[model samples]
Target: MHTHTSTVTSDSPLFDADGVLLHRHPDLWFEDGSVVCRAENTLFFVHMSQLARHSVCFRDMFSIGTHSTGTEASIKSESGVDEFPDYPVITLHDSAEDVGNLFTALYDGPNFGNNDPLDFRVVSGVLRLSTKYIIDGLREKAIVHLSQAWPTTLKGWDTREDTARSFEMKTGSSSGHMYPSPIAVINLAREVDAPTLLPSAFYDLCRYTYSQIFEPSEDDPLYVPLTYSNASPAASPGPHSGPMQLSLSDTQRLCLGKESALHAITGLIQSMSHSQSIRNSGVQLQSAFSFSHPLAQNPAHSAIIPHASNHHNPYHIHFSNHRRSSSNLICVSAAACRKDFSELVELATQHYVFDRERGFSDPLYVADELGQLKSAEFSNSDAPECKACARSLELWAARERERIWRMVPVWFRLSMDVGAERTASPPVVDIN
Candidate 1:
């Protein structure tokens, strides 16, 4: 006849038939008359009679100790076994299997006395042991603590050189050779969300890096200008030589349209002046007394024609002269000089139809005419247009004279050669 064996899964603690707690390996159990255990990574089975003497217990198979005549006294006596040497202490009132489960839970949970020194030592020791056993969780926890404690403990190794060496020593050759620099440490802090240490380390690293990269030399020009200005004479050539001298082409390239033309003219005038061979030529002022208006034959040089009393004269009267033909002679007041000069320059530059048709032979004649009018005396009563035109011409002449003067050397010998002469007579006026 064949016999059938049944298996039962129970939440109750595992125990021997006599009800004594049994300390079995994780993959072992004791139920009814069977002893089931794993050894050397393999399962094995035996009867209670075949079990080792040390592996068996009597009196309430789940109990830590045997029940005696005085049960309370025996329980009390056994309870104190935890304080005795060479006695195994029971942490939980359950079978050895339940106790094993509880130990694993405590090891994995936060209730493992996280703040205690002894707990830390135990955890570290377990982690070290786990590395040999290839326990993933324990090894990972060890790494986390090591990385977290680095900033606080690695004080002397805050510099790049020191940090690199320390990291190498801690992790060993294979893993340690890839140690981070101080800058990398700061970056790691940022990655790991260490708020307090990250910013401080980051700033320090930045400053150090900048200092290394941009260290100033003793002879650097920028340093002299920025540093020793007060201690030294102001005229001393700063470490910098001088303002950079630009070429004409470069200046022209940088200049705006009208500004470029102006700079070109200024440079030309400066060059001419610097050459020193150029003479200081004089400009001629036209003789106002001899000037004749083209519009009328034998026109009066000075005359004042009265206007109607009812009409208001916009200009104030200066000196008015009545000479020959009833001509009104007027000179611009100083106040109206600016407006007249502006208008005359505009009129002089304009290409009038009459001037183009006539094919004017003498460009100098127009300039002379403008110059003559500019010298004409005028009161405030004179027409603003005439006064404005005269004043504008005077300003134009002054500016032109200045421009011409800039092209001449400040001092030059007057030579009789080339039609130039030193005469006892007053200087001849030449307005070219």
Candidate 2:
């Protein structure tokens, strides 16, 4: 004898038999809709035609006999009795907010042209559902929106940094106010398998201290909502209702990436201190700026500076015995220019770039600070002469920053083509 297994479907209106009230979405609930979707405590009454139009998953589900109005498909209370006006109900495993955002994108055609704080919320929520339901158009749109905020190019990163600085200067507020928390971005990137977003996201997350990464405070931007709809009340404990935690794999990625960033900081200092050819000019080295390098103080530090005839090193500024040409800007008072470069490098080391207490892990910020040495405020009163050498220094710093930016994906161990603007699956991170 063959035994039949009957599946109970929960599709009741308003409330289930368990007294669990399902809140109907204020904006998404259409009275004349053909289907109802229950996501946790929320209910969305939407048209099946529209769902099938945007989502292949829904269309496939409908193509099967699952939407039938047979007794097996009828609404069943907790007690297994049929009830309610017969509308086909589908239960979504995703959060109600995500479902709502997905529908909003599908119906309204992805309008994300706002500078609000909740922009990440809408993009992330919609992206999750769109990717899940195989909505290619919506998924691509969401990726574009995400890539704009957390861009792939070095120029885009520079623009984003400049905009944050501008916002900070104009409003006298923390630059953190202008962008979403990178921790949240990292989480979203992993959740949606968007590997292209990982490099910038991981680099941005390194801006926070070691403590801040693991133990974000109450005011931390990580707690910001991933989706905020003015039309709907707050969601209960759900996917995006609270701050998201990184998986052990992601945490390992972050910790290792942060260490690499610190090493890059040392690399910036070296590039500023050593990697320049005073160029066809006679610049004599001076002992004006001979402070021990911050890295040299560490016990595990390597001898990055070797003993050479008054030449470039972290501890001393040495130059070749080439004759100075009075006509050349860098060659004119070359010793003074060398001293000025050394002094500015020391100033940047102690106050701006390499200070560990300040927790400055941002190589781009370090590069920008190093580049700012061209100004009279940083250099000697002889702005014309000092600026010539400072310009070379600035160029070197810019190049170092670009190099570091390119290495970000490698540092994070993300298997992404950093040169390309496309998504990939999250790499299988090995915590072991």
- Cα lDDT computed for each candidate against the true fold: 0.29, 0.61
**What does candidate 1's lDDT look like per residue over 164-271, in tens digits?**
445557765422233222233333222222333332222222222122213423332111223221111211222444322223432232222223223333333232
Error of 1 at 381 (Å): 89
lDDT of 2 by residue, 361-404 (tens): 88777776776675555443844355445544543454456567
- Global lDDT for candidate 1? 0.29
Name model 1 segments beyond 4 Å from true. 1-20, 23-115, 146-152, 155-432
Best lDDT among the predictions, by candidate number:
2
* Ten-residue region with minimum lDDT total, candidate 2: 317-326
RMSD of each: 39.9, 10.7
TM-score of each: 0.16, 0.73
